[model samples]
Target: MVSENETIRRHEQDAFDSTHSQEERNEHGQFATPYDLARAMAEDLQSRVPSDSHVLEPSCGTGSFISALSALSDSFTITGVEKDSSLSETAQRLWANDSCNIVNADFFDYASSESEQFDAIISNPPYSRHHHLSQSEKRFYSQLAVSFSGVSLSGLAGLHAYFLLVGTGMLKTGGIGSWLIPSELFSVNYGEPIRKFLTQKVTLERIHFFDPENLQFDDALVTSCVTVIKREKPGDGARAVFTYGDFRSPRKTISIPLRELAALPKWQHLENYEERENHSGRVLGDYFKAKRGIATGGNSFFIKTRDEWHNEGIADEWLSPILPAPRSFHLSEVTSDASGWPQESDIALLNIPRTASYANLPTPVRKYLDGCPEKIRGSYILRHRSPWYSIGNTKSAPIVCTYMSRSDSTPFRFIRNKSDATITNAYLGLYPQTSMSEEELDSMCNMLNNIPSDVLINGGREYGGGLKKLEPRELMSLPLTSSPS
Candidate 1:
């Protein structure tokens, strides 16, 4: 009977989903949690808290967690906060007779007035990226993060991290929190704070990573996880539980000491890592030093085809040949033309060396520099540089790599660069370090391509649609066939 009602609620959620476009929801970070997944999380939390515990959902959209808890037991005192008026009203109306209170307010605002107030907090918080926030908002979230866990969260963190950590303060010392969030939180650089919060600030009971290929949310492209954390600090010799596959019937499980878990660079690295790490002491870092391609203050305004650059009356000295994004290239290997431009495209970066004098520049070049948009000129990357127009590090790469790939195709590709032309931020420049021979490099590239991308990229970042990102450092750590010294 409860299952039947949940189905109805899900249908109602779909009805509301039509009112707003996916882009709107993405900006608001308002993906609704599935009823079954919410129920599974609630069942875990339900076992930890007292029957009469007052539970809070910090970023509840349409009461998925409330419905889950209600189905489990009527004894749970349920309160959910939703910022969207339409969804908040719908949640309030649906659970009016079920003893659930749906508060239409921002979770951050609600959190400010409350602390140590709930026995359990079950939520699928907003996954809005950091860019959605204003500077003042970022400052507030960062400062609060430090206050909560003594862990300085990166400003690059998505909105979900703030909600996850802020809720920790609202819980009683032993309260349980079960959040349904994207798996990105376990591997991204910004996720370091979350790992620390779990192992240092609280006890992580279990974190179950759903198979990326079988995503839990049909509407979202991201792989999801059930992060179950207890409010109390980790105890001595505490072992955090790690699980994979379906929550009810996980395919694999591992328990690592909380102390040891905290030491790992990424929590997601626990997936088939040991079995895949079979290698001589050397990795790609031994043969090549991976450097990310240059970043322009604004790609569109600063980068243009040679024809486009010439038309603008800018001198060739102000332009440097650059490889376009990986999507633009059809072949794995990039070759150079007689003029040193990439054969694929005539794209060139606006190269103004730091040592170049702005006063002695040509009129056309000065006019071009002056024409830089205010937004681009004031960009974080540009403003930090000594000369706002200066963009160095444009050098030929011996070998390059495409960072991400679809699950159906190869996970990563190592492209041999046959060009003197450099690359943009689209690729990683793998410059030879150990005087690796050409045949050895070819063999190494073949070996990397042959290894299962999942095995090769284990412990790295993943995205929706089974897309995986190989960080510059991750590229260096990749196992290599080159003989170790």
Candidate 2:
């Protein structure tokens, strides 16, 4: 049995989804907050706000927070601001009987124009990727951040950080704010500005990270966290509490002095970290030189399975054994057969020559090249090469690591490559440094295979839909906590 409110909310959501394409939602960085999460945040917020306090919800999509606010016994006035007009109207209709006002306007512009101080401001701000904003908008926000928070945010920081900074300006001194944001802020370089502001300009309170394995939003694949902050500067020797798991009752919590947090480059490292006396450590880059695999502009046209290659009569000389995509095999160690092909997988890349004599080539090979479409030939990767089909150089490396994965449990898989096979850009190849001898290859691979899951999560960046990605630089920067004998 569905309640009237739930049915109405579903219809409104359907209308919103139908009117806006996925691309539009992505561009605007709009995703409705889950009701359970909203209610939980509102419950936590109750203790912070004074009686009859005026509250503001920035970028409120259909007023999840407004609905949550109504559940409380406190008599408070709330203002919900949303950029999307239709969503604002829907929220307005839903909260008609409550002391809620919905404004359909850009939050940044509204925040700038307002002189009213809010007792509290809560939001699940848009996570707009920096690239999505035009140069002028980014520049404007970057400047405004410095003026408001005394921290000049990098252009690479997401729009959510800007919202946090701007919302702080609207809060009355000693007021609190709670934000639902991605966990990347603990690890990514771009989050430095927000970190600095929290340390210097405002009172850092608490952070609750949702268990990475259990995603908070079904539509979003990001590891989410709720951050609680106060507008007032911290007292001397102040500490911030960081918790992992459900906000209602976290799995673990750690208290760190604000001064120590300001010194750390990666906040995720704060978990279970103890300072070792006189212990020195090196990063993965000191042991290995990591490089991303070759990228063929078009995988569909150039990559072929074993049966497809055999059926097409592709010549052996023009084919190179290529490892299958990450999902195809589940082995930590890959071995090769007599033909130097990966025994666990059967895939080949159509490797063409830079200079070829068409008349002298086998009839089958020539026919295949003739069938190559203009689009494939003109692809960005191939167009620069002398022959469009000629692929970049590739060689087998002793170890490989997956660049991307959807599973938080195994976001990065290390592989011991006992095969003379090249990989696509989907993987990263790691070669031993000068100090690491070939004798240590087996030990190195074993160590990589056993790296703790938490270490991998802290070292990599997460995308929407809980996808984890690690660039060659980030992989190289991983701190090696264990050594091979």
Candidate 3:
């Protein structure tokens, strides 16, 4: 007869194998946590759990938590479950030499059936949304959340929130749990349910926000935070420790009173508290509607310099005065001619005409249009009554910023528009509402120009070839607007 622990491991492995195919795991964002991160999270929980307490790692990818528990001499019982079959098998193999109970079933389903309660729960659950869940699975998890937290999570919420909610149900009264979840929950709209659960359902102990500059996962691009909470009666004066930097060795730590955290509508406000204070005057959202520049399906095929157009006899109407990638433009004050065209600049805007206007095109331009490839002619731009060469209204905004930039260079730098050329969709257009004067705009531009490079580097996201993209949402969230008047 097999030992109890071995039997449990086999049962878990068999269940996993029966349920998940290899392709399904990859689609579900099923990357297992690194050993170091698992160990660190386990150690943090171990420090909080009483001796001999039962600990559950729901959605446990391959028993990293089990391995961590094995190292402890607290007489603790560990119950680990993984939904992915391959990972569950790997977990069983890694812990083959050890003694621990492992389950190879979906934790969401298991939690619904079982009434067993644990002294502690720890997990790095899946990050995918309801789209990954079957219709029935979504309904099950949705009902579970509504029953537990009284708040309905958005369908867009990742699978991890469900794990957190279900895991909360499996915990014995006064049991503490640590979750390795995305830092975005503290800030995103969909994360409100998770936040509400953390604030009201449990006594949140601490939140460790990792430095975005040093991301945790090689495959995942998101920032992460470790949330520790205990099941207890909701009470006032519950304080939460906020630590930033290395979890093993933090650089900055703040103990935020729970009252303050609950009072704020947005938790992202806490990430950069100092910046928030400095820019509390007025938000960019208060005065302007910020939008991304544009997204051409293929920039290489679409954007061309004036020389390239002239040498190839490409129709001027086929090009638009698109701002070169942020690197190419240096100045701030862009000037357009009386016709709103860039004055005497080699940078020509792509300007295709509508079908009605096409008949009026010059001979050279008409010939060029006729010579276009069949593939190009069939594109969405060409299919429209107006072709891709047709430019949108040339209305220039008072201010423009590079939408994408690298961290190593500068943070938020203003472009001095010395050139008579306009930008394409690679820039951010800042259109002022009816709120501020010209003097204020000039002052705002100067203030933005002087923003420290470090702040800019931290705020932007990276791309290949050292490229970085800054969305209006990210830019608007910055604390710069909070600066003292």
Candidate 4:
């Protein structure tokens, strides 16, 4: 008879070949965790799991966690279940030295049937969104959440959340789990349920947020975090650790009392160390409407210098005094003319059309546009229908934020809007309405401008050439000075 290990290995290879064509893996965000990260997460869990514990690694991609567990402790019994047969097989081969119970099965399906509870559950679950799942599958996952957390999680919650919810359920009381997931859950609105579950149902022991500048996954661009939690809530006054910076080399560690964590509405704000001061009345949100910058489908095609506009025979009306990407706009305060145009500026602007418009431009411009490949045009600033120009008027806002920035030398930077030429979508335009007093708007602007660059970069997603993009929702989540209505 074939050995159990060899059987598992064969199944894993066969399943991998059958289930995932290379393209499918890429589409599904199925990049396996690097050994280093997996090892670190496993070690982090081992520090919490008691000796002789039963550990479960749900959604074990190729058994990185299993390998880490085996290396960390031979005494701890391990059970690894992988959705992909080929990966499960590979994991079986990798852990043949140890007698791990390896199963090739879908975690979402198998987890519900598990009769035994584990002392620790660990995984780097797939990040695929619910849309990828069938309606029946989504309902199954949603029902699973109800079974696990008592509270229902939206199907919109990413697969990772399901793993956490289901994995937590499979854990014995006092069981601990460590997960490698996108740091976005801490701040995103959709993650509110997960956070609530963590704080109330289980003990959220610690979260180690990685620096956004040094992306952890080669295949994925998102900044990630390792969340360690226990199945049971700790007693009163218990504190949970919140570590930030490089996980490999942490720079800061904070121990926040569970009560305090539970009190806070949003966990992302915790990273900023927000302190609530005694207040008498209203908040900034009460007085002024906070709005992020407009998003031009494409920036390079729209934002251009006057000289470039004139030289290219593009109308001045088609161009605007848009802020350069974060790196180019260095100054905080900008002086503008009586009409709000920049008094003196070094940057130049040029007109380019949206994807469809490119083919219809004049010969010279068309030739220039044609020289650029479709791949380049499809990116954020290039995909618009009329790429050569944008629509925002020159009525400048009192405050502006760099839509994209970096952390090379300067810590955080914001440029004041002083020109009549309004910025394109690459900026957060803060326009104060007539209802709000100038002082109140200025105060709010000052508060926004003061946000640290590191925080800004971390909150936003990065693009080509280290460029970062912040959606309106992401920017709105930043801790701003608020007064009651």
- Give each model a TM-score: 0.80, 0.84, 0.79, 0.73
Global lDDT scores for all candidate models: 0.80, 0.80, 0.68, 0.67
Worst 10 residues of 3 by lDDT: 458-467
Give the Å error, residue 444, model 3: 1.9
Q: Write the per-residue lDDT of candidate 1 for residues 68-176, one digit (tens) a residue.
A: 8888899988888988888888778777565678889988777776554888999888878888888998898777767666667888988888888888777888888
lDDT of 1 at 81: 91
After superposition, the stretches of candidate 4 with alpha carbons farther than 4 Å from their true spots are 1-26, 36-40, 96-98, 129-137, 154-156, 211-216, 244-251, 265-288, 307-325, 338-340, 345-395, 408-412, 433-485
- Give candidate 4's TM-score: 0.73
Predict model 3's lDDT versus the native.
0.68
Ranking 2 against 4 by lDDT, winner = 2
- Native-referenced Cα lDDT, model 1: 0.80
Tens digit of per-residue lDDT, candidate 2, span 1-485: 43365457667877887788777877778878877888889888888788788899988888778777777744878989988888888888887555777888998888778889888888999978888999999988877667667778787888998898888888899999999988788778888778887888899899887766666766555678899999999999889999887788987888989988898766754567543223227778888899888888888888898678768887668788888888886788888899898998888888766566667777777788788888887777777765666675868887899978877577788888888888888899998876555457778877766667767766777665556788888898777666655
RMSD of 3: 5.6
Error (Å) of candidate 1 at residue 191 is: 1.4
Model 3 lDDT tens row, 1-485 = 32344345446545664577655654586655666777788888888889788888887776756766776553777777877677777776666443467788988777778778899988888877567778777788889877655668887777888777778777888899898887767665677777776777678898887766555665555667788888885688787788887887888877776667776545542555534434455556566666666544345555677788776676555666656676665666566666555553556655654543777867666776576667766776557634555545544566788766554556455653433355567677777767666667777777777766655544554432344455787667444644323
Error of 2 at 437 (Å): 3.4
Off by over 4 Å in 1: 2-8, 97-99, 274-278, 295-325, 328-393, 434-452, 481-485
- Candidate 3: list runs displaced more than 4 Å: 1-26, 93-99, 129-140, 263-280, 311-319, 330-345, 353-394, 416-422, 435-440, 452-470, 477-485
